[model samples]
Target: MQKAHTSFALALSLFLAVSCTNNKDAEQIAPSLSAEASQSSKDGILTSELSKPIGMSIDQKNQIWVSQSGTGKNDGSVVVVTPNGRVQTAFTGFGSQVLPNNELGGLGHVLYQDGMLYVLDGLNGRLYIIDVSSYKAKDAPVPASSLNFIAIKPFVLSQNLSNPLDSNLYDLTFGPDGRLYIADAGANAIISVNLATKALSVFARIPNATPTIQAVPTGIIYDGSKFLVSTLTGFPFVTGLAKVLQISTSGVVSDYRSGFTALTNLAPAKGDDLLVTEYARFVFSPPVVGWQPSTGRVANAAGTTVLGGLNEITDIERINPNFYYVLSTAEGTIQKLKY
Candidate 1:
């Protein structure tokens, strides 16, 4: 186990981008861990082989968090791992235990706010508030079948808005002001929910004129002030536009960046830097999945940063001031980067 863990990390380290330097030489090549993998598992490293590492979030304690949805017959789950890759806890919800691999059960997206963890139920379209200290669902499931008639029933958040979300409620996060934000990729809208009163409102919606199959907003991140979002374009071949839409505390939305494809996730680096993963090749005949490292001053937003090529980037997080952690779903490896 130790050797396997080290090999995985070494493979993933090869792709981390060091700086915003457009020059190829400035890109940082991660040191191979194959030589040290013998010490990995013994050191408490955790690893996985799954379809996609769909979403992640960090708690006040700074523990790294992640969720994976299996393709079919795979039994999806949510995992909490230490900075060193040790498994903290893995959740396979009570009712979801019988869900098929690709049925979208288990955990889809996790959000940590105050001292609670909010998880979106992919199969049932329900939102569960989990006690961070306990890691258990606050209430039972709220089925879409009875959502309309119910009155803010069972953590539904709101009956005034759409209930039983259309499809996979992919990503979720809280804004700087404390209101809860969720990305409904299936419904094509970014929504904000009142945590205190269970009221729901659409924060941002993908325009129908986008000229893609359908827009699926997968990830949400707060850069201390605004909410940054990632949208997977609906059409194949056309690079899925991964854009950042800035939303103020007042619910104002503005275009931040586009032209990049498959912006699946985002994390803040030290200074004004961000680590963006580009799965540009996912829409092809055979999915060309890779991760890219890019850095730039915050003012530029997008389109001007120096972007490196893909390197199996599934999820990203700023583990510390200078180190960023990335997940490679296919490689089943986690990487640490210093930028």
Candidate 2:
């Protein structure tokens, strides 16, 4: 890739020609979850007490990789949890380019495929590619270092600490078309990353009036066909305006659900319809909307309730054809949910 800096076509072709290796590790680690893990109200905490953790994805062995925010520049890190629930720090960043509070920037989300890991460094407007395989010539992954860290120009927004779009990057999911789909919340747009060339582009942008307050996207996924994006609105994040948008491969955007208040993530349920998580309900205060500790919940495709009383969930993963797991960023936990 370093050499390809002189040859764009060579880089893109080499990247596009390679199919993502389906390294079995992307699925469940166990043939079957244990009895204790299968309980109806299962609350098996995979990892807990994290420092402002946000995004996560599973690897070949069902080890959960999480993006954790640090207190200052260069403190953000990526951590992993084994199938048996042991946690390990995989790597960290040198720090973000801008920040006012600790939570706004850092390594925000992670996407794992085969032995490769893609991390979004929101503060610096860059993407870090890490080699997760045992034979990586540089040895195992380490903090503040990477196999590659490519700069994304679009994410280099106003470093003004007051900019509401500061959470420049949010969630990420791999598209069947061999690209990475990213939720650029601050810019009110969905971005696509060319894996081969490490190029960035605005795939789809919400046509709303205020990107600074209205159209922050958080969660995104590819359902083997089209894409679904979740958006957050207003600061302290109000309840009414947040929603999920249906995005086409050609960059068309439309509302999939408009009634959701403080929506965080989306995933297909074990049965029919889609499953969504709400960040919080509306209440009175200067921060008109805020997270209610242990109050997040999930709903079905038709906007009907399914599960309730969760703790500030940011992402969800369906591990099988029958069950799913949700991430609580606040609680730093992952709990299995049976739909």
Give a tens-digit lDDT track for model 1, residues 1-339. Answer: 112112122222223211110000012222233334324434222355333455565554444456655443334555665434455445543123323211224345666555666666554556766555654323233332322211212333342222233444556776655666777655656777777777877777654315424445556777766767655554441453556665666666676676666555666655565556654343223332333233111112444433343345556655445545556554455555545
- Candidate 2 lDDT, tens digit per residue, 214-262? 5556678776567887765545345566677888889899888776766
Error of 1 at 265 (Å): 1.2
TM-scores for all candidates: the values are 0.65, 0.79
lDDT by candidate, in order shown: 0.48, 0.61
